[model samples]
Target chain A: MGLAERRRILELQQTILPERERELADICGRAIPYAVDWDTFADDAEALSLLEYSACHRVAMALRVVCRDALGREAVREGLREVAIANVADTSAMALTFEGGVLRLRGAWGQRSAGMFGDAEIGALLSARL
Target chain B: MRILLIALLASTAWYGASRMRGASATRRALRELGHVAVPRRLADREPEERDGLALFAFGRVPGSPQYMGSTTPYAERLVVAAWTPTTRAEAADRALRTVALGVEGLTWEADAGGDAVAVGTGTYEANMARRPAWVLVRDDSARGLTFAYMAWRRDASREAALRTLERVAGSFAPALPTAEYLALARARGGVR
Candidate 1:
């Protein structure tokens, strides 16, 4: 692209990005307070592109923490899947479920990704939510 | 009626006092940031200061190349943000893990440091690439964590990227302690 064109693109990006960050931060902050900082995590085009992907992953992870602390894995998984279905596409192989407020990991993918959340994260989640 | 008026006056005074304190903190932080060079464009938004954690952006002029006659924008454009988590030790532990995960690919590189770099009062990690011109630095201090990432379309030198990162990082000045950041983070109201 030409300089003027690239400059235009950059200008457009500059205008849109901060608004997008604020919107996303607001959405994430609703469920996880400190999650607002996630908006700051992305600094450029590449990072901005990855922002949505990482954010989904982090929110999913935060939900797992919430499940472990509150209802259980299955409920959290079910809740996650519901939210995912409503908001995401093509999550067929994803594994995370809860039964009786207890979390269970099934499938190879599920087992490998287990135990990702910890106390501080959970605290961050609670601090944001509560 | 008189009692109600008195109560309203008291509440208004308290609110005014609280706002004054917040403004004072923000001014102090801005004063501290005097050493940091923030591009005029991004600095226009003003810093979003909550307790000691501040978030803002800085970069080469939106469209101008990093250097004159460069034909293209700086191979590395960065937006830097610094925050001091309310729960310092606890937040730092989690932040360390978060930064580690964030730079997983960089960590695997042969030249990557085996661990974080320890400077006077901070720990830093950098991910650098020679081609495509990208560099990311994640620095942690008693205050909190500062993240700077830059990626360019062309081959940019590591030194250039690091310089931009440092320039932005050096500009952030935190005024509150961890306890204060925590109090702000945990405050009942959310940041707008």
Candidate 2:
């Protein structure tokens, strides 16, 4: 699918999601600007840290399959990877993406918390296949 | 001169020990995800792990690290991550909220025999497009849970990445951790 087409899908999904969910997302979105720069940590364990990070969290992926009119079949891998982090709220993010089958992830972590993605880890995830 | 020489040796020794520990732990991480062989060649040459699975670092140094279990046939997640690249804290919570608006369900976990998929708290429209990531995951029995670890990003070129990630997710099986593996991780402030 193309960018234009994807935008259309996003619009549709936005409509379907419950208002409360949207409200939560909006709340999270709103608090971002208020983030204080106190939860910073050293990124020295770049490699081992990601693994350690991975071990502490749980991720789930969702795909919305699409197809065209043809002899072959097309599947829009529409799903979400609910990333589970070890927290009181059992908080985690979702890895939701599509394009030849790669589900990338964007997440949220609370202030003074250690569940956020590091620079190297984020880059690898972006560069990764899904 | 003697003191300087001893200091240099001590520094070298410290570096070696750290590297050894890092490599061993990363291997165990992959093994925890069920990859048997621990690779040690990311230093000397190319990595010896599976083509689509391994521990990848940005360069020879450490700034941030990512443990990649495997790639799914999905894409837009990466593109989404491109736009709001907040390397610092505070913005992550908002990022997740923004991205979560699109993809909200479907996490994979490890099954006893292999892997299985679970439908969790997804807040998506059946026909919606442009999500953060798409996963074909399974239940992880060993870890006593479903949906282990993952990253979700947002972007403009989302459609392209989505198509690709789906393909990657299809041609593989979900993985679960071993008992010893979970125990080890939990021993170090880690949990399943």
True contacts kept of each: 0.00, 0.00
lDDT of 1 by residue, B1-192 (tens): 999878865664454333323321111123122224443333223334444354443333223211334232222233333454443334333333332322223332233442242211112223321223244555556445554554342323445445545655655544333343334344423332
For each candidate, the DockQ is 0.02, 0.02
Best by TM-score: 1
lDDT per residue as tens, model 1, A40-110: 21223323233222333334444534555434443333332222111111235333343332232212211
Instruction: Chain A only: give the TM-score of model 1.
Output: 0.27
Predictions in order: chain A TM-score? 0.27, 0.22
As a TM-score, model 2 comes out at: 0.20
Q: What is the lDDT of residue A28 in candidate 1?
A: 38
Task: Give the per-residue lDDT of model 2 (tens digit) for B121-183.
Answer: 332322322234433223323332222112222211233223333332232222332333233
